[model samples]
Target: MNGDWLIRGRDGRLSVYQLSGDAVLCRSERGRGGAWTAPRTVGGEQKLHPVLGIGQGIDGYAHLVSWRPMTNGESGLVHSAHFRPHLGALDWNPVGHPRGQGRRTGAPAVAVDAQGRAHVFVPGEDGTVSLLAQKEKGGWEPWRELKGSSVQDCLAAATGESGRVELYATVPDGILHWRQQEPGAQPVLQEALQTQVRPGTLYALATSADSTTVFYTDVSGDLCAWRPGDEPAVVVASAGPGPVSAVRCDIDGHDCTLLAQRSASGRVAFAAYPTELESAGAWWTESGPQLSLDATVSLTTDDNGRVVAATSSPSTGQLLLTARKDEPGLALEAWRQV
Candidate 1:
């Protein structure tokens, strides 16, 4: 794989490991990106939960979100840090705790618009969704509720040439809800549907490249996909015993592709649905390398079709970061670093 992606994970102990990378270099106590620098403690005294978000800002810098358990059992507090573009260092300017909102925490969600500003989505204690956007002057804007009711989960998608952002969240009641914010305009809900996706409930949400389709799962453990244009929801994969996480990638604009992994095993699997051509059926047979890794895994991608996947192995206590590219023969096995 020519394109390699990576992540840095800390287990709340004193050690921080740079995920698999091509650089093959390690330094002492590094945080905020560096060959090695001192790791900055952001999540306070508690163990930093992995339910955070990491992505590139419009300015081409890496940004991070780390949350900690708060006073209320239902709500958690979050913090933000921006890494200088391509500089192995993190900028700690707008740092602090989420305020003015009742204690609320769920899966942390993030999105960066055409501008470099970052937007973070958290479920509020009131059962409504809230948002936090970065300010030019340095400081987090007050939390703004984006939607009402508890969100099942959130997956962000950047759409159009302007790079407008849309956050897709599934409601506990089984409705897939979405909201889009274009720089200066007000954030509004797009649509909601009963969408009998899965019975077990949604564990994650991922969008296609164009932000047109939304893929989700139900409590019954089935994988289903729904888009604005598609009339009825389609089940892409049936349920397994435990929870399953899905990541959608645009193999090509002419087709739709998905990669899903089980929570317990950390084994990754793939599914494809073609639009330009007629396939065997609506859902293609599941295929691809079955990854057997030690750590629980999370997946992300870059613009160049490169994937960044992280696995924190409970067995070895090591966080493994791997990158795979959808090349001609098979997913290229390019090892960047470990």
Candidate 2:
């Protein structure tokens, strides 16, 4: 029910994961043109936190991560699950706390490299960033702390065209960035960039093979985008105080980026603009009915390349979805409950 609840598989099928009670439940499409199955439990025999971290690798598998609270009441442990479209999820595996101590302070953010190794990043209660990564041959390296301080729980990670992974975290003053020196290498901290970012509103989209642009709501509730080293962050539109979800797709043979978020008035808002051209401007269009102020919205491209947006109904808890119609401009089909 939190974090990114929607994902597209390598097979072009889409899957939605949500938190139900202490277990994680999933409803998935049979295939590109198939039907959706009923919701079923995919994780959580041990009690789990509501937050879920999901990342997809090049190999077409979705990696799920969550926190498992210990019975003794000490800091909980981190656990992970893996799933493919046809094959169901594997048993949840324990990924002990970073450095083997202290529960992660915020929802974990995961990024899988070109080699298909998943790297998990979590912010510590002490305001440090910790990383637990998969080894090439199979297995995990010890959890290590990446250089950071005064870090907020909201974090973002993505793999760029160079096949290296990059990470971003918000601090009291601005944002912190880190990137792999090379593919599969340990991520090294880059220069800290100063900007006023709202906590829990960071999202990263890989704009090109070598560059990734991070989007977030500023403290003033304006949506902004910044590609490290290219330019200062540009305001794209005004939005509510929540995380924004975006995906890049071809609209009428033109490359475009589509964004979705919960509006200040509680409706899901959609926007479209030329990719990397924030200065061109975008208009926010509210769609669907009002939702909980904290409800999360996710966007992904279907197999046919149509943009799909999804969010859970706060009142009924049913899944609601809408897709871009195959027409000129950014027209959408009616919202449908799944």
Please give each candidate's TM-score. Answer: 0.65, 0.94
**Candidate 2 lDDT by residue in tens digits, 212-278:** 8888788777788888886655656566777888889998898888888888898988888888888
- lDDT, each prediction: 0.45, 0.80
Which ten residues in a row are the worst by lDDT in model 2? 74-83
Measured by TM-score, how close is model 2 to the native structure?
Answer: 0.94
Number of backbone collisions per candidate: 29, 2
- Which candidate has the highest TM-score of all? 2
